[model samples]
Target: MLALERVSKTYPNGVEALARFSAAIKQGEIVAIIGGSGCGKSTLLRAIAGLDRASSGTVTLDDEAISSPHAKIGIIFQEPRLLPWLSVADNIGFGLADLPAAERRGKVARALERVGLADKADAWPRELSGGQAQRVAIARALVPQPEVLLLDEPFSALDAFTRRDLQDHLLDLWADTRPTLILVTHDVDEAVVLADRVLVMRPRPGRLFDQIEINLARPRDRNSPLFDSFKRNVLTSLDRSLDRNVPDRDATQGPGQAMWW
Candidate 1:
């Protein structure tokens, strides 16, 4: 239910973050975007969420052009941007201020319970650990029952165990709510396991290089031969994209240069 048509974003310094990047995502689909460091993966998410305007073309939701922050969209950033002054419950209900007290409370309760943090309702933001804090952030986003969920490296900073736990939690949430999901990540294995489709991007004007569909069944087998094959293909595409700057060499390059694969 989302579409990007020739979308491009350029910074004030004239660096093109995106170049004619386009994609059409169906409702309830989970898509992952993987690419090199400087690619416009995060930039594309901002444009779709209407957190920033594109330099050219359009981002549309349900066929309507999105110009600014809209109710249909929800985003979770790398850091849990919780207000330390607010309690867990209050932070979740922050977006529901216009609703009646009872309705807001009910909404927050359901969201907290869904994220398995109902007990933390009264706890202050400072009292929660990193994973707990991120769960609260997810709860806050889901409280609005958004039509689309955008996660920009939401689990990147957490430890391996915590990240895996949250990934399963996220899938459960998505299965329950069925919101269109877009995840920007660097880990190929993570992308393969989590996405219905993985879009690999190239930098230096960041654009879509390949759209790899993961036809594997749910609860994907990370050690399966097919899974490894998909990961290899994604890595191969990434290696090809690295030639955008530093031509491919048979030997390793100096620091700050792209490593040849």
Candidate 2:
């Protein structure tokens, strides 16, 4: 399991981005973290990725402390951030340099086929489209088979159609390994479509406000009433997180409950 115990972060300039946030995520679960600006969504993700250390508390994967980047953790940013000089195949296999050449080549070849980029193996980053580049980025991150993966608004830069396409594609790839996924996203639809549970955070020294469990099954219907219901619950929670004055709908329903079901 991946666990965050009282994790907090305070910048050198005295800005407290996160405060005593804690959650225990099970293996192979997909969890989305959503919140308004300065809510520490990215900060929390970075802390988990070990890209940044928390001011207090701890992040551990399978009981191993993570104060720095660990082999078990992989992170993908909003941009592809691929090396311009490297080919698509090379970029995907970048992390497997320690492996023998034949092993590295075999893994990269399989990843290319998996991402449907086999024909673009020799293509440069500048030569690919926005969506294609992002696919390459996803392949690179997944190729390492990390125990946990952190995504920070990875598909935000693409068009709506492409974004949705990649979302489904990501789920397909995820099924292959079922790694623990921790995503930070602002899109409510994206959160509903991809996450098993949606974690809503409050801003200004960010902390968990509410968590809504999405009980819908795989290959979810975007137009289904249940999906919209979950979306509304998340939106309502987001509004309340930003401003506590927003009246709670169905006050009897507890946090993490799917009211429609």
Candidate 3:
């Protein structure tokens, strides 16, 4: 299990990105964190991934302390970050730095197979489409079979159709490997469809607002009444967030405040 305890980040420019942020991700479970803009969501992901150090907190994987940089944990950021000069196979094997040539080749082949890119092994990053590049990024992260997979809005930049396809692909990958997955996203439907638990975060000093357990069955139906109900609840929570920010003007209120069942 990966745990974050009382984690806080304070930049030199006097920006408080995170404050007392605490959350834990268990083995074989997918957890999604959702929040508004500038809510420290990305900061939280970076801290857990060990890309950025927390000002005051402890990050632990199992019983071992993670105080410094480590590589067993893999992070996929918003951008693909693929190497322009390297082939798809070579890019995926970039993380296997210390392995021997023969072992690296085997691992690279397997990783490509996992992401369904075995046939495109010789393709360059520029030659592949956006979705393909992202898959390469995922393959790179999965090559080592990481203990924890940290994703920060991996689908945010893609178009709607591509986003849905990638989401399905990610679920399939997770089911096969069963890595502890933690995704940070802004879309509530994406959170509901992808995660076991949806963690709602509030902005301005970013604290946990709600932990809504997704009780819907697997292969969730986005158009069914059950899925509609789930979406309604999340929208309600989002509405509450916006209401809190608006001024107390009863005359200016709209009529669409009615709650859905």
List the candidate 1 regions with Cα displacement exceeding 4 Å.
244-261
* Number of clashes recorded per candidate: 0, 0, 0
Q: Against the hidden reference, what TM-scores do the models get? A: 0.92, 0.94, 0.90
**In model 3, what is the error at residue 131, expressed in angstroms?**
0.6
Poorest 10 consecutive residues by lDDT, candidate 2: 252-261
Residue 113 miss distance in model 2 (angstroms): 0.5
Model 3 pairs whose backbones collide: none
**What TM-score does candidate 1 reach?**
0.92
Give a tens-digit lDDT track for model 3, residues 76-186. Answer: 989999999999999999989789999999999987888888999999899998998999999899887888898999988898789889998998888877998899987
lDDT of 2: 0.91
**Tens-place lDDT digits, model 2, residues 39-126:** 9999999999888999999998999999999998998899999999999999999999999999999999999999999999999999
Candidate 2, after superposition: displacement of residue 183 in Å?
Answer: 0.5
Q: How much RMSD separates candidate 2 from the native structure?
A: 4.4
The TM-score of predicted model 3 comes to: 0.90
CA RMSD of all predictions: 3.8, 4.4, 4.4
